[model samples]
Target: MEWSRRNIWCVILLTCLVFWVMLLVGLNAVA
Candidate 1:
């Protein structure tokens, strides 16, 4: 159970990182 919880957290963090990267790229493209 602990392992599963940790895995979920890692996935969430990775997704968030990807989202921020995409947002930055889009803003740069616009400017």
Candidate 2:
């Protein structure tokens, strides 16, 4: 699959969102 500009952006945004969600959940669990 070709990594078009839109596709790359989508993957980056999705990764960022997933990372943020996991970080928040981890902090909540620790606290």
Give per-model TM-scores.
0.93, 0.88
Candidate 2 C-alpha lDDT tens digits along 1-31: 5669889999999999999999999999999
In order, the Cα lDDT scores of the candidates are 1.00, 0.95
Error (Å) of candidate 2 at residue 14 is 0.2
- Each candidate's clash count: 0, 0
Which 10 consecutive residues of model 1 have the lowest summed lDDT? 1-10
Q: What's the true lDDT of residue 9 in model 1?
A: 100
Q: After superposition, how far is residue 16 of candidate 1 from its true place, in Å?
A: 0.4
lDDT of 2: 0.95
| lDDT score, candidate 1 | 1.00
Candidate 2: how large is its RMSD?
Answer: 2.7
Any residue pairs clashing in model 2, and if so which?
none
